[model samples]
Target: MKKAIIVGSAISVIGLMLVSCSSTPEATTTTTRQTTVTAAPPPPAQTTTTTTHMSGSGY
Candidate 1:
């Protein structure tokens, strides 16, 4: 039983080491982009003026 336990533990450790060493690390990069948006100003509101003449004005 003791020999079996030791061999099993050794196998588990070697398996973990092999898996960790065989994997490759990946490099990651992030970039930020700036964008400008331009919009035309709206036109001013129009106003109309009307003049009325009254014929009779008495108090």
Candidate 2:
């Protein structure tokens, strides 16, 4: 019984060491970027008017 227990314990310790010391694959990371654009406001409206009157002949 004692020998069996010692053997079992040794095997368990070796298994744990192997599992802890093994190398794992590196993880991959992805990055995303976002952009936003805003349009400028239109200029205000403007109006101009001109009038001319002329008198003809003699008065």
Candidate 3:
């Protein structure tokens, strides 16, 4: 029982140390979590032209 208690405490301390040691850099961590999105602008208005030609002849 005593041995188990000592071992458990040691493991807990080691885990805490590892967690504290592995923090990500500020820039790197922020970039990975950042979300960037851009939407395309609307297309310019289109103009359509229609032409009609008519010929008149006596039938």
Candidate 4:
């Protein structure tokens, strides 16, 4: 009968869908390790100054 044929087709289609959906395994992402670098300290700060004199004051 047409009804039986339709039912059989529907069942077959559902089985095929489930098989296709679960046929392949999921892929996982790989992580790369990270590296850290440390830098050396900077040199100390320095400053110099000079004094000025006027033409003839006892100073």
Candidate 5:
């Protein structure tokens, strides 16, 4: 009975150690993207003109 208990304890401890020391899987791929935008042109300039008239007779 004592030998059976000792063997069982040893097996349990070895199983726990194996589980703790195992390696896990990881991701190895990466992705990236770039974008561009265009702006509109400015509006054109404006011009104005004025005229005046005079009479022959004075007040």
Candidate 6:
């Protein structure tokens, strides 16, 4: 009974080590996109002028 128990434990530890060393690393991926936007038109401009004349002195 003692020999059988020692053999079983050794076999279990070796199996765990083999399984841990056989694993492969994972891979990753990335994606990107571009977009364009249009600009709005400018507002209209206005101009106004006024003139006033007064006659009071002659020399």
Candidate 1: stretches off by over 4 Å: 26-59
Pairs that collide in candidate 5 are none
Candidate 4: C-alpha RMSD to true structure equals: 11.9
* Clashes per model (N, Cα, C within 3 A): 0, 0, 0, 0, 0, 0
Full-model lDDT, candidate 4: 0.88
**Candidate 6 structure quality by residue, lDDT tens digits, 10-34:** 9999999998877755565755567
Compare candidates 1 and 6 on TM-score and give the better one: 1
Clashing pairs in 3: none
Model 1, poorest ten-residue lDDT window?
Answer: 23-32
Off by over 4 Å in 6: 24-59
How well is each residue in 2-56 modelled by candidate 4, as lDDT tens digits? 9999999999999999999998878869878899877878777766677786677
Candidate lDDT values, in order = 0.88, 0.84, 0.85, 0.88, 0.80, 0.81
Cα-lDDT of candidate 3: 0.85
TM agreement with the true structure for every prediction: 0.41, 0.39, 0.40, 0.45, 0.39, 0.40
Could you give candidate 3's per-residue lDDT for residues 10-54 as a string of tens digits? 999999999888875455444345678988999999989988978
As a whole number from 0 to 100, the lDDT of residue 48 in candidate 1 is: 83
Error of 6 at 31 (Å): 11
- Candidate of highest TM-score: 4
| Winner by lDDT between candidate 5 and candidate 2 | 2
* TM-score of decoy 2: 0.39
For model 2, the stretches where C-alpha displacement exceeds 4 angstroms are 23-59
Whichever of 1 and 2 has more TM-score, that candidate is 1
Q: Which scores greater on TM-score, model 3 or model 4? A: 4
